[model samples]
Target chain A: MQLKILYFGMIAEITKCSHEILAVETKCNSNQLETVLKKKYQQLQSISFKLVINQNIATKTIFLHPDHEVALLPPFAGG
Target chain B: MHKKKTVFIEGAITPDFIANSIAKHQTKKSIGAHNIFLGQVRADEIEGKTVQAIEYSAYEYMAELQFHTIRENAFEKFDLTCMHIYHSMGVVKTGEVCLFVFVSAPHRKIVFEAIEYIVEMIKKEVPIFGKEVFEDETHQWKMNTV
Candidate 1:
């Protein structure tokens, strides 16, 4: 499965890029995805952010599909 | 749902734009009350550095969706004649307008309620980010404090 991952705000600073494509097994969930990301980008482990799947906030247990849209969003400062 | 409008502006929102918006609404005689919420960038001292400006960014696809949801809910919950939201996308210097929320209604009460609800939601729910740049050009991410 190829997942399109997005990074924003401080998280993007750590990731050094705003977007990426991840290869994962179809049975995987966001929790496993987080573990993989945290290992790949060590700075991500210390930051506070929310995971969004397909434009909606996602829990760790949500299943991921191929070509799924995922975003790691830092704390919002919008007004 | 109301037709979606472009919410992101390239730079700081100018007073002339605001005044033009107000002028355009003069013909809307049914709207007796209009409440506006403007968010201005502030120069805050943090760790001995003064924030001189904020460069804003966002997951724009998600932000527009969030705005649409908030707009739909406001229309359902309030007696509003119209609502317009404008937010700055790039650098907005200290004291410049970054966010502008305008809600109009037939009466004052509903406009007040609508403005509060809409502004609160935009701050809490939208995925927009701001990088606070210090006077020396060093930067840090800004976090919304609920």
Candidate 2:
């Protein structure tokens, strides 16, 4: 499956791009994807972020789909 | 169902805009009280670097959805007559307003409580990010502390 991932804030700085398409295996959960991302971008391991799957915070394991919109969000700093 | 509002502004929220918003509410006779919260960018000295401004960005799609959810929940939780929220995008200099939240209610107490609740939820739930730009053009990401 191919996932469209969005990067925001400091995560975007580290990833060097705002959005990208990554190919992943079917049934790959968020944690597995996190590992894959951390390996790809070593700086990601040092920062705290959350994975959003289809606009919802992925607090638990969520299976990835090709059509799902994934986002990497750092800690919020809104008023 | 409440209509979705455009909450993102391209730059700092000016006093004129806020005044206009309040003026437009004059026709709302049922609203007895209006409480507002304005978030200003603070020039904080961090490790000898002074913050001059904040460049804000967000996952806009998710942010709009989150704001909508917060608005809906506030309506369900409080007896609010109306509510409005606006946040800055791009650059907002220090001492300028970055966020404006206004809530109107038939009573004074409800507006006060609802304003605080809505602002707090926006701080915690919204996925907006701020990049603190320093005097020398250096920058750092800002995180909200609970």
B-chain TM-score for every candidate? 0.99, 0.99
What are the clashing pairs of model 1? none
lDDT of 1 at B44: 96
What local lDDT score does residue B5 receive in model 2, on the 0 to 100 scale?
99
Scored against the native two-chain complex, candidate 1 gets a DockQ of 0.94
Q: How well does model 1 score by local distance difference test?
A: 0.94
Candidate 1 Cα outliers beyond 4 Å, as residue runs: none
Per-model DockQ against the true two-chain complex: 0.94, 0.95
Report the lDDT of model 2 for residue B97: 99
DockQ of 2: 0.95
The digit string of per-residue lDDT tens for model 1 on A1-79 reads: 8899999989999999999998887788999998999999998888888989999998548988876789999999996
Q: Can you write out model 2's per-residue Cα lDDT over A1-79, one digit (the tens) per residue? A: 8899999999999999999999888999999999999999999899999999999999899888888899999999997
Q: Estimate each model's TM-score.
A: 0.98, 0.98
Q: Candidate 1 docking: what grade?
A: high
